[model samples]
Target: MTVHLVGAGPGDPSLLTVAAAELIRQARVLVYDRPSMDAIAALAPADAETHVVGLRRGHRALSQPEVNDLLVELGRRGDVVRLKSGDPFVASRGGEEAVALQNAGIAVNVIPGVSAALAAPAAAGIPLMLRQNSVTATFVDGNDDDEHAEPPDWHALARLGGTLVILTGRGRIRRIAAKLIEGGRAPDTPIAAISAASRASQQVLRGTLSTLPAPLPPPVTFVVGEAAALELTCTSPKAS
Candidate 1:
């Protein structure tokens, strides 16, 4: 009777909220994002109808319109669950889908989950904030604009002096970091590229803007801040 917007929480099934998990297990029509991974799909009840919209691309995922249409049509059925990767409300464009369904006279509910902006960095042992360091946190989506995208207004963020987490920012990482540097952030500012976050295969690469050209894995998350530098001290020493 309701169209629920559920957050799959980064990539870990265990991170899903109890309510979100319940909604998925009880769902009969599960419209999901392929990026959500097998761990998330396993949550679906045995009898549910699962639609793997982005299966072809692996977890890179579906176009917004396709995901929107699926959610809206499923809503018309009166009991559908629109599953999202990471917290549905984060950079997820969940609001857009919710608005579309509501405009079509469909009731909607949101079940929150851990967002990559937070989980990714935490997995690398980088606290987004600390008492002696950053006191505030700002989350930005690094969706590049035309021409490889203009970077975020790094000057403004530099002025604010807080923790910065950039989501969907893999492609624009170098640009974003450069902008922040030009905007007055330290060139040695700490950065962690957390990819496939929260999963067993998750990888974290720590570097400064000067050393960022090194190789990295795909589907990554970028966390930028002076606080991020602590990742070195926070991480457990590796075996010889």
Candidate 2:
């Protein structure tokens, strides 16, 4: 049996790739992370066995090791779908799970999807790169908890000078902003926070390194750079 690691995209059911949708539809067992993924998980066959391994109001959250063990056990039974939000590898534990499954001698397949890092900025009309303003884009995990991995170097990021897309950084945005400023980024450097991107509830808040925007709900993607100030989607006539 093979376990399919599928990207459910960024909170929108319609954003799921054709391959991802097809796999879910045929899944004999569906495993997903957050409760927010219910919409996409609903695509699986009604009889499919479903498991939620992440945080839920009444359910115990599964640790990374527990999740990997669960996937391995499920993979031996039948067709399994491990649904992850956004792209499976982008700031996600999907990679670790994949490794565990492979080491257990189970076949694994990965399906790519649109990451929120890219979608959020686009939905907010903030270009991650502009011809004369920004030529690079850097993506970092704001809530990284890997004990073996070194923490993000915020100071170095500020000095690099590019579009910075931080995933899961909503809670620590203020401190992050301070670090950026300390690293030489101007206090006026534009920043934008896009929450629930690509969904009906999507919200975009704008500010700068010195004046961070008010907190939005979870699942926020933060864009920091000159490009964050440009809302190309705005139709208002520009001052000539």
Highest TM-score: give the candidate number: 2
Q: lDDT per model, in order?
A: 0.78, 0.89
- Consecutive 10-residue window with the lowest summed lDDT within model 1: 231-240
Best by lDDT: 2
lDDT by residue (tens digit), candidate 1, 103-188: 88889999988888888887777888798888899998887563544656767876676788888877777777778887888888
lDDT of 2 by residue, 125-213 (tens): 88898889999999999985568789899999999998999998877888888988999899999999888887777788999989888
| Runs in model 2 lying further than 4 Å from the true structure | 234-240
Clashing pairs in 1: 35-59, 145-149
lDDT of 2: 0.89
**Residues forming the 10-long window of minimal summed lDDT in candidate 2:** 231-240
- What's the true lDDT of residue 138 in model 1? 93
Q: Please state the error at residue 82 of candidate 1 in Å.
A: 1.1
